[model samples]
Target: MDRGHVDAPEGLLRIEDCLDADGNVVLPAGVTLISLIDRNIANVGDTVAYRYLDYSRSAQPAVFELTWTQLGERLRAIAAHVQRSAARGDRVAILAPQGLDYITGFFAAIKAGTIAVPLFAPELPGHAERLDTALGDSQPALVLTTAAAADSVRGFLAKLPSARQPRLLVIDDIPDSSGADFVETVVDVDDVSHLQYTSGSTRPPAGVEITHRAVGTNLIQMILSIDLLDRNTHGVSWLPLYHDMGLSMIGFPTVYGGHSTLLSPTAFIRRPQRWIRALSDASRDGHVITAAPNFAYEWTAARGVPDAGDDIDLSNVVMIIGSEPVSADAITTFSEAFAPHGLPPTAFKPSYGIAEATLFVATIAPTAQPTVIRLDREQLAQGIAQEAGEGADAVTQVSCGQVARSLWAVIADPATGGELPDGRIGEIWLHGNNVGRGYWGQPQESRRVFGAKLTHRRSEGSHAVGVPADGVWLRTGDLGFYRGGELYVAGRLADIVVLDGRTLYPHDIEQTAADSSSLVRRGYVAAFTVPANQMPGATTQDTTEQLVVIAERAAGTSRSDPATAIAAIRSAVFRRHGVEAADVRLLPAGGIPRTTSGKLARRACRAEYLSDALRLR
Candidate 1:
């Protein structure tokens, strides 16, 4: 915890500013999140801490604001009730819709000194299994929900085994006056503050054990990285609060005493214009900062921003595009579409992060345009990142930006564990105070993923500043490379498809397949590999792997023939990547598996395909 004798990055805050030698949060003066909240209350209590845009019952949005003092009072009151049913270090799950109550419940669990598990409501469609799996894995001692959802929540809990059901508390029922009876609990920076569950795109959802130290350090790191330390930097987000990027959007504003406007993910999906309108409103007060995935940007640019008209002002907005691979085309399209509405050329920020790192790792500079590089497709497949020559087979990649101040990221060979030089794609291993402790309740897997070490490398560009003294590193399971001080994320290591000694990125294949036919849902395609023996007409000697394509037909596409779409996809895959699709399955809309955050769960889809569980058209 001491992190002794390390050189701090120039113009960047030290990690020790939040974590002391004893690993206890530097409190009262306001380094940690709780202390910052308390400090904001003491200094600017009347300032708005949160603004919830509610659209639960009507098309018109009803906005509600909570000042620091009001937020503190409500959270403390709910925390008092939570403490009655849960103990310190115990898991307290928040199973509620996104709104004021959900935000209050999350802070209430933390205020009660319990490990907060932010989860979605059971009523959310297509995620019942995920909810059950998370509940079973965390085994929370208490569950928090709103009065409006109590009955449905109770019925959902009743379906679980008696031992797995946690005591449920309606957060809306708690009176603000009950804050008087609450007792404060002293928490160390090393204490586990929350359990951030992974999206489970490749495997089951595993809760990342985020300590108070990691959270505080990551908040500071992000604040510095994005130049959001200004008091007037406001936040607007329609991302789900349960997700890591979404949580960071809220945390960043709260820690820095800036106002944050939030709405449900469903609201944004229903009408992305809401997010655009929120940005316009937030920018009037100060510089607006927001974050979203690549697809959201594409959808909003194509649908929402085009309809925003002349009155919207986007001059002071800084939007962070992440959570999935950043698409250069999306950035260009979005920027061009919004430029007439006072959007700045440098507004688009491409970043790379994970839940294990408490959200932020690297982001584009505030005044720089989103960078894109074209790599030779063949060289990229061979694990190199050299720029492609003119008229060559090129793959465009967006730069994820430089590493944060206090973090050290090294690209190391996944097999040899040796650090790779610049322009070589490899697993991204990270070391920083911002890294979480590990996965909750799984020691072996935790150690395997979080306790990595770099093989001693004597070459240049291997050793870097901010390396942990313990020599431990976090294996991100993501494949990327460092080029000219910026990180270029290639793809996921597990999601890589290998055939004939050439590696293929599933996203590229999926994109190609989607573009082949208008009836295919663009973002709903999944491309994976299956053993040749698993497919029909495969002899025992055919031990190689074959490519499989699964795509969803767009809704209301009865006029478009499914066979034609399938034929186009097969043709496109063969033309683009020189690989014949051994099997192409056409399904109805929403057939592909997706994580809670709307990411394509490729591994899960492959399993379902193998099991013949897909609802093929």
Candidate 2:
């Protein structure tokens, strides 16, 4: 297989070979992000990567994101300690919220070349079981956590086997003579970077192994996509770092002369306008780049663009839309709402990617105006992306852009494993340097995903060096089509709801309600199958499938008045998805279980629903 190279139209993406036909890139035994940042800081002294309003200090303080030199000092301290304490290559677990400390601890683990396992930071209503399962699956030797979060996971650890228990390494600022290993600073990237566990609802959370080389490659891909490194653009982000986007999306952009504004999803969801205000209030004069899922835009559209407290302009903001499937209406709604504040319609960059692909595979270039197609909703919901034109009630399909300059995207028949043609909805497959190594330790499933490689048109001749062996591809579980050199997403093949010969993706239905009138207005609603038998080990949401909607009221609106919200959502779902909601419950804003990185935890939300958590008070 040929190692592919990125040849972006702009001179921004020049590369010196980006492929390894041998299927393995030689990497140091146990590298970490600490090493990378440390090297950068040591080499380039006094370069700021983050600046923020220290509410406690009540002034803008320039936090050192990295100055190569400072990074070296910190990582050196942490790496030396970890390397000295290797007990059969002990795994270190990070069970803390997002902060500088979290980043440091993670980098320390990487510098030690120790496997870093990140537990989802969100409070899963019934996550103890999942956490216990993950702990057992990874069988870590040590765990690093904050005080409060450590308190929460303490009891959960007791449920594990005595021989398999992990040694707790807490990063305590408020110390009480607790005798746990405390990581002060991470120093290297030659270690196993991290083991990001998938959110396990239907299946167990698989750990995806990452290395220093892999992480570096992924970060470079992100920089090229957004041009953050070129001409020195700045970034403002609210994405959580635990997920791929948080790790790569915001941080990588901030690595080279780019600054980042960090906020938790809960923070942004609580005040949809904060994201806008972040961009408007930036002190720097560079193209502001950032990203959020479709729901974020819907939330802003619902809350109504906040009055720019200080003549805030978002026209220069290049907001990337990805994570979940991108919806045309949600982007349009947000673009129109914030347009008055100088929010450019082109700034709504609709793109496609996932965690398996390291959070970014393709993006609608830095200045390329977001291209959207109006398509037939009925046809689309049924796996046919017949394009429609500008009109009332027409479904807007946004292009996710072509494959990332370093990545390859292919639409294939789910059953036949054969590549499909443009405009024909099928499973979206990916292959490239950006593709992550298979899930950690779960070799069987990993082979099923990353190991099952495939060839594309580019692989036919000289490009054949990189085509996956055995006609395999990254099973995106997403349904989409290619047209006019751009990608238009239909729905997720994995989450499709096939009813009475008609097909629909749960996200599509959710997007419709999120985009349309205020029924769901800035809220969360989902549809899942509830089997008629509710039998143990029952798979698929078919035959016994039921739509369950869990939503948060708009900001400032109390959940106590959920009657109106529920009614609106119920009516909208019925009208659009043709699937009646089994029940609609209004949860407090931010109540929905989300991924560590702030993605709506639909399965977790569904679990809450089935347990009467979706009921009105």
Candidate 3:
């Protein structure tokens, strides 16, 4: 009932800030990929750009602060190094975790007009094959790694033949090589900025070309959507920098917004409580605006039960939940569980976005706190978002905040591609400047999501996208509906179930299991559909009956089997959403396939589940 527009962003923070006094955005004729973020932040001058957390055990080790001035110099140094050691267009692969040097390496690659590839170190196991493939495909000029992870890369490189190997550049374990002479370099917008590998939750990853426009557009929209312009905002995130969301939200936002950003990987993992605690630590000065998936909230929520109000304080947290289906129960649990510690329910920000659009697509305002709609399962999966009556089962309404400043979204029929009316469930299509260029090597795949073309009409201007048919609309392949000027996500359409003729979104069952303590981690459940007809012995009844959930048993809980987990999950889903989940697997940690960024790799997990190679203990 209470709806109000968030105050309009003032000057300096606007995307136009990248422009000069005359209003020219880029630096004329040719702007290199690397200098885009760095130069813009530098134009503002001496502003605290990035704050790196130094957890070195050395007695003298302390937190290192880098400003726009230092960042410029660091970039220059790396650019100079690029000129001596590698070719301009050659790819420079970052083989490490997220940290100060990672940002420095990324900017340096862009500054020198070289394409950079950020590979998550832990995900290397998943990419062993892709690493081999990338080595042959791109023939990277150099591989950069931190001191700790350098050996791992070295060992992997050792496995490859010397002819196909890339030179290694260790930041922490640097040899006698110098990296501070080549400062002068030229770059263009069309030039490739970096190469992004596919999510790679399954087989080896494939390289995707990420141009400067794609990366820049993502950062521009993220800054605007999250209100990063507010001078007081201090970005804090546990997201891994190797991933798009992690790199853009935590790294790019700092450069674009001209605010101090704190980076802490250990503090976040060792004690998830530290995310809120860190904000609490910084609260006396100004609040911290941070982000993470809904799972983080669930992690902290469990802490509330044990710790209660003993030392938790989340007054300074504005946790933006996304990168997966947003959970309403997780929001309520996080909000209510932290109330005793001064955290308001509104601090929970449910959002929607994907890597193709950069990172953020739409973000809600801080006005109504968080709103969750308890909707009927049948009506929702049938492409409708009807609000169930008090007696009807419903989903929590922690809506992903309203459309970000300049973005547009529509729910469209998956097959016909026609826009659906409000309250109708369908794949949500997003149209905006934030949309990425396309996949790197898979033009056909790119055309699949981005389509061959799209057409759009708005005050900003109408335009065509892709070829003839790939116009203004960008199909997100996500199941959701738009109503009352806000977007509500149901789940992925491919992950839906049409058991016994009634449609069901995977999220409906996922949420039902999450609401119950009997299930594993709030996100321990992964829903996917495999063709039952594949079985030579199966019939039409089995073929049409798709959907088998792979639910990781909550740590330490007994009742370990697909039968128990399935029955419990089904009965609950049947009671709540009026649908039945065919299978609910209870596996240990890391049993389910998750993308390097930790998203559920339902498709891959399903393949593994059917292979019988994946066993449930």
Best by lDDT, which number? 1
**Per-residue error at 22 for model 1, in Å?**
20
Q: How big is the positional error of residue 424 in model 1, measured in Å on the Cα after superposition?
A: 0.7
- Give the per-residue Cα lDDT of candidate 2 at 314: 72
Q: TM-score of every model?
A: 0.93, 0.80, 0.84
| Candidate 1 error regions (>4 Å) | 1-30, 306-310, 468-470, 535-543, 554-556
- Which window of 10 residues has the lowest lDDT sum in candidate 1? 1-10
Q: What lDDT score is found at residue 451 in candidate 2? A: 59
**Candidate 2's residue-wise lDDT over 1-617, tens digit each?**
11133232222122323324543332333333454354345444466554432222323333335443444454455555555555534677776765555665666666565777766443545456666666778887777766657766666666677897766655544232221333444434433567766645334567777655557666666666665544345667767666666666444632343346666555566676666777776523556677777777877787747764757767557788885467666777887887778876568778776767666767777668878677777887666778665563456667877665556677777777766667778877877655667787778888887755543343332222455455456776667888876777776565677764677677666665555435343536555655534523445554665666566655566634567667777787778767777656666656677654445667766666566555432
- Tens-digit lDDT track of model 3 for 1-617: 11222332332234564445743233223433455454545465466677665444542225666676767677666666666678878888887766778877777777776788877563345546545666566678888777888778888878878887888876644322344466566677667777766565433465656666556555655555655555555676667766766666545544444444555554565566655655666554455677777666777777523354456555656677785568766777777777777777667678887766666777787645666667765576555677888777665554776765445676667777665666777777876555666666668867777752322322222122221344455676677766676777777666677776677766656667765546566686776666777522355555555667667767666554546556777677668765555556677766877666666777677767777757742
Candidate 1 structure quality by residue, lDDT tens digits, 462-573:
6454464458889999999988889888888999999888998888898898889988876789999988787645666676788999998876786777898899999988
Clash counts for the predictions, in order: 0, 37, 35
Q: Whole-model Cα lDDT per candidate?
A: 0.84, 0.61, 0.64
Q: What's the CA error at residue 125 for candidate 1, in Å?
A: 1.1
Off by over 4 Å in 2: 1-35, 50-66, 87-89, 120-130, 146-161, 172-191, 199-204, 249-259, 266-274, 281-283, 300-316, 389-393, 453-472, 511-519, 533-592, 611-613
Which residue pairs come into collision in candidate 1?
none
Q: After superposition, how far is residue 62 of candidate 3 from its true place, in Å?
A: 5.0
